[model samples]
Target: MHLFSRFQFRDWLLANDPALSRLRMASRVTLTILLVFLILLAIEAFILPLPTAAFGLGIVLSIEGGVAVRDKGNARQLVTRLFGCAVSLVVVAIAAGLEDQRVLSDLVFLVIILLASAGRVFGPRGFAIGMFAFTSYFMGAYFQPPLAELPEVAIGPVVSVLVGHMVRAVLLPDDWRRDLLRSLESVSGRINQILFKLAALAASGDIGEADRQELRQLEDRLKEVVLMAETFIPRPSAGVFDGASNPAAELAIRLFDAHLAAESAIVLSFQSPPPFALVHAVIGADAAELKRYEGMIEASKDQPQGETVRALLWLGEARRQLTEAINRGGACGFSGVDAAKDTAQAQAIDFSLANPLLRSALQITLASAIAMGFGLLLSRERWFWAVLASFLVFTNTNSRGDTAMKALSRSLGTVFGIAMGLVLATLISGEPDIAIPVMAICIFLAFYFLQVSYATMTFFISIVLCLVYGMTGVLTLDLLKLRIGETVIGAAAGTAVAFVVFPARTRGALDAALARWFQALRELLGAIGEGKSGFELIALSQKIDACYRDVTVAARPLGSSWSVVTRPGQIRQTLAIFLSCTYWARVLARSYEAPPADDDQRRLITADLALVDDAASRGSACFFIKRKASRTAGRHLPVSREGARVGLEMVGSALERLYPQADTLPFASGEAIARSKQG
Candidate 1:
């Protein structure tokens, strides 16, 4: 135990090194889960009966799961869970009211499961589909036998689940507003650090391999913080809590956009070599920039415009760097040694291993099937069980990796809870009054260990199950054994269903993500070359970010255990390249001004435009090419400087290097004509 504690402390310390931001976040989550669990247990014990408690617990779990998982939209998850529960209940009711025919009941249940499973298979869209199936299945099952007692059995669990959800929403620390603010601050700080590092590299002219690697690491960290800011949500409106109000979340959203713009600009400024001294000068100037931002944040205590203006100014500075970097190449007399390193680093970042759709589908299906199977086998009413199962199916839809850990935890938790329940029921059969306090204690223990590991969560769940079962006075060792057996059966069935039916292939998903990323890259190049507006360009950048996010989520499923089959390092490299390109495009867009009429400037623009086109095409082909022949063929796309236009000399050198091929153009002349019109 001492060793284990020390190990945990060491791991936590390592993860929280330099800054305790991540540690703080974890602490917040733990506290939030504890509060939510307590409220839920109180409701179950005092306000709701056993069946309702079951239903409500499911709802709370769903909401909690949604919040804990990154990259999932909480609002969407909530709606889907509720809808699934309702639909499953309705179906179960209809089925039960119809007849006692086992065939009809079974058919309805199967259909519901199939439909729910279909939703699970559909990825993000499955939330609603799965919900409907769940509701139908459970409601149908409940209505099947002993019609008079159906409502009594059904209402308890349904109400309980809903209450649990309510508790989660009400008690959990959303703190999105604060989180966003902090994230923005952190990102800004990091960006400043990177700028300073670049300046130092420029001034010293000692761009070693280590420095190059450090820059890449910093860039990765910058991207992560910026992404988090982009996805931050403000505190939900009062109406959202009661399912009624609309709070203006737009300002919070705009903050993200501005941050992204600024981050992109920073990335681009570092892409090619720049005058180390000039970069240093820029850093000095940015000190005032940071001060101004801090002042704006202070002033914005009572205003929104201040925040917006501060973000805009930061973005503007980033844009300024891009313009200057593009106009003035290595003027600081620094050799392009670092440029070579940058190229090598770019090569190191590969994208061939990102799988988006398959991983998402697999995760959703596995989680849903597991929950559904458990509900079906254990619930008193077949129809009701089906509905409950349906609800459980969509619980982890938005989570990555099929929530393998969560499923394992839930199954184990239930088993442990059942065992505990049996012991409690046997020891305290004559004392029903003592069960409530015991249940509360058990709930707390479960929550406390929720973060510890899967096994702990399972243990907590076992206690909860025992308390609920005991409440019904059906507390016998034999019955406890039966309940445990049923739960295990459900878990097995769910796991089987996930593996057998439309199994999600991580590799296939990665391929699809790569395709989307290539497509986005192509669009972005087209937009930039045509000198599109900032808003239009920003929208494209957002799309690119989304695609990257999808890729990240997909690759997550191939954790350490699956390393043999999935080349995560290669996939990460590919994602990095895409991210780097996107960052550059954003900078270019910000720096882009209408081309001057001078022949030199016009010529520079044309050459630069052609290079951008070539890079986009090459990237796309690289993503799609399977064989060496295809890759080689794709790499041979034409490069030209045919149009003898003025104002193009400044960019001529850069373009030649960016696109080496001297033969064919990727874009059609007609498309160029269209761009001309748009410009």
Candidate 2:
């Protein structure tokens, strides 16, 4: 695809990176930011730079400017985000109206922060809106004059949003929907190709580890898409044809699992003419033929010596399920969320005062306020940048580690920006014509990469500021030095506040989440045994995946496993049991499934499942509350199947290993044995 080709660029822009690969955003933002610079340059052509900069700052307070909106996982559409920015701009205008009254202005400022900090209820979007409003309060107050200047004060932000909407609607095309459809189609097609290969393997009575790994990778990607995809009823295709949400990939996932399960049954049973080989012969047949195959398998289940017939019967059933799933893929009308569950989820996000949001809001607001206070006490010119540094630093930070890293990134970017800014300002010190155009490019690049990296945005914004200030006739060594010191002060204050209040020092949440994950896995094992097949298994898998993500996110801030209560490998090994058990359970649930071949086999299967279930609970208990668990001897597991015995022993051993350390036990080993005997 041509990088500059509008049609080709749309696909890249639709990617889920920080850049979102959205070319429209880049183009529209550049236009808006440059327009701001150009307009400022013309207004301040013969005047000093500081006055124009003050007004320009107020105008660019929308998120499209350097407002620093965080992208927390899933994002709304471009139009939605822009609308949110516009809403925040209204607050900016109101703040300007209240500026003459210091008490009211300060009161509104704190209220904005309080509302923004309600992350539990509003999630990231609400926080972003509130935070933008709060950031604009600084600029609005800077340009405060009297009630007469309301139009002038309101014009900057209002124009900011208006310009954005015009550029988005009139100039650039939004291709998010088209790109998502293309991606879904491509993934689903590739998955079907894999399913065909698995069908061939089944027909040939062969199974390879490499093929299984490919299915596993497919499973992982499918899960990732489910969690990351923005749920929306897509518009008509190409603005004409009918369309559906991206359920094609999800349906392909189910088909892939079904084929994999069939292969497992065939491999385990090791029977001649592996089940569903006949179905594979008619791989591309229509749904009617697949239904007939399912009926044929059902009839075979009643015959004597159906143990081997069972595997083939199950394979036939899987083939039929594949046909059904493939048909469902082409037409998705799923209610993406249940009303009751979605409401509950929204309530949780809307109201929980999670430590992350509460602490972040408190820390950043206090630090910025204090930084602004210090600047007022010193009566310094260009004091707004000081508060900006604190706000930006705290906004980017999540933990002690994140704060340290962001501060470093900020300092380095600032130094380079300042260096470049000094050179550019010196070259165009007297020529507004040259300076304005140069700053225009700086503003364009700054906002263009705003979603890409905070460091990169700050780097260009620094250059823009230097040129703007130079034009203002306020570019000075003292002011530059003051800005750097203020940033450091704010950084220090933010880290200090985090340590002192609502600190997230423990990995307790991650531990609890893991415990819940294994518990769910246990339930899934039971469900599979009961021949259950539905959305419940999918939801369970999603929960397990969510637990892993929680741990990964939690691990980032603390930067160590020191806080974890359980033996890390133990949980992981137990998870391994989870996968194998689920796979075998699924195989047993198939239509041709028999009673473990004989009575001994049945007894062994029951014993293994019981022991594994007991082990899973033990793992969960140890992981969540550090409760000791002990394994009981397995008496009924037969020696016929090497895999079954080894798997069961692994589960039993993992369960037994959950006991507390020897030092935690009061009695010696000999005394413990004596007490056991006496009991």
Candidate 3:
């Protein structure tokens, strides 16, 4: 005992070491399961029949199975499990009544399973199909008792599952409300950090390469955090037990918009480098003001002063603009420029009309129909085969990559599970006394390792199933083989159904994303030309981010369709040039302090203004041209750096090439020549 205690202490120390902490998380999870299993055993012995406990355990185990493996929303998981279990139970009831026609019933069950699997191939549409398939197979083949016995078989599993979910929710360290609040506060903190950094750079009158890189990384991290927060909010459709509706959701959105505004200001600052003296003075003042406001926000949390909090929030926002101006060489200075005006326009630029819900529904329906049809052709009972098919269908919901992973894992796991089951059955064949304890051990191991890997968990489940069947004196090698074959058939049918029916076209999605990208660039340029600041600029930045995400998500499915949609690559290249030009225009804007009377200063100012107008016009034209190209086959427009001197001309040329048309030309010959003289 002393040696064991010493060893345990040493292991704990190693697990807690910083380098090994990740391993500790998994270890902790394993230990938690073991504890839960022990408690479950106790409950079975004292409060319920052993079989009932097993059934409940199965439901509990299934409900928790995918949470650690995939990030399916909690609400979605709950819905899927409830529906799957309910459907399975109903099918079992029906199958029992047809016991007299065992062969016919088995064939029908197989058909139903196939159909259900096929339905799920598309997306959410086939969810029901998969559930029904699982129900039919288990009920028709294994649980061959009377209708009265059916509920008994299910009660244990359902109870076990309910307990498991309750435990999971209770064990969660932080509630959704707290998490949402933290997310908001974290975003606010990030904004403060960015502003402080910008102010420091301005005060120094030198934006080092390191500072610029740091700013870029901060902006990227802010975007990621905001997106993650959005995911944490509960969907409206999630039922009663779902995470509570966030009262602060609107505030979070506002904060996100605010951060975008700050980011835009930073970008503009970089483009239009501010005057050194004014930049230093403004940065110094803004830094002190921002610190004060941050303190107020923190104080408000404890004291609950609404007006104070609002004032602090507004101050923070004001500082964001001031920081932007300082970074841009104090071009716009502290003048109140409304930033929130362009948000609505930015949101209106969605290019793809493909709805997730619609895609999911179609995929599910198609897969189910195919699986059902195949089952019927095989002379199987429609409902039984349909149920089996349903399980396979819902395994993947329009994500081909996810579907492939699940199929591979499920197949491998099933194979290993079958072998384990066979071995277990042989071991316990004549040892009736050891059956219950052995079964209990198998259950504990399976549940504990379910999250370790799909293949391993499946193997564990197969062992449990085999053990149960053997205990009932009905386990056979032929039955084991049959089960394996059915799983393979269902998986194959589901995958094929996904590929053939209303297949999601990655190229079309990519094209739509490219169109959006051009539109975003047009808006960004237009805003800059109009001297957009505050909310408007921030919103534009957010729209750009969203468009980029859309393009990325769409590109993943492009497989062979990438070549057909040249828009993604083109738009990406165009955006880079557009961003550079916008930055330069901002620099020029900042360069305009008091009116320039000197011939050189005046010429530089005039030339920079002309370049800004030219770039904006060209970008606007390119947007329309891209839209037109998407609607109809058109020739690619070629652009040339006609009279540009300080690289602004090259930027204009790039924009022009994106949308070359006689009527769409944005710059006049005189304006181009005048700007060329200044450079």
TM-score of each: 0.50, 0.58, 0.46
RMSD for each of the candidates: 14.8, 11.0, 14.7
Higher-scoring candidate on TM-score, 1 or 2: 2
Instruction: Provide backbone clash counts, one per model.
Output: 67, 11, 64
- Pick the lDDT winner: 2
Task: Please provide, for model 1 over 340-381, each residue's C-alpha lDDT reduced to its tens digit, 9 standing for 90 to 100.
Answer: 111112123222223433443443445444545455556544
Stretches off by above 4 angstroms in model 2 are 1-28, 35-59, 64-112, 118-120, 123-125, 166-176, 182-360, 375-379, 394-404, 423-452, 470-473, 506-523, 560-679
Residue-wise C-alpha lDDT for candidate 3, range 1-679, written one tens digit per residue: 9999997664443322212222333333343444455655676678765444244335433433323212134555456556555655666666777777876765565555445544443344244436434444454455465666675556544543444344444443224444443444445455556656765765676665456557655665555555554444333332111111332233333544455345554553453333333333333555665555555545434332322233234435545543342333223321222112112121232223255434544455555455555544543432333334434444433455445445566677778887977887888777867865665565555554543455665677678778777877778786676666656656665566556655544444455665675566456445545544333443454455666555555544433233234443343333434443433332222222222233433343344444445544442233223322211012110111111123233334444445445645543232354565556
Task: Name the top TM-score candidate.
Answer: 2
What does the lDDT come to for candidate 1?
A: 0.47
Prediction 2 global C-alpha lDDT: 0.49
Ranking by TM-score: 2, 1, 3
CA shift at 666, candidate 1, in angstroms?
23
TM-score of 3: 0.46
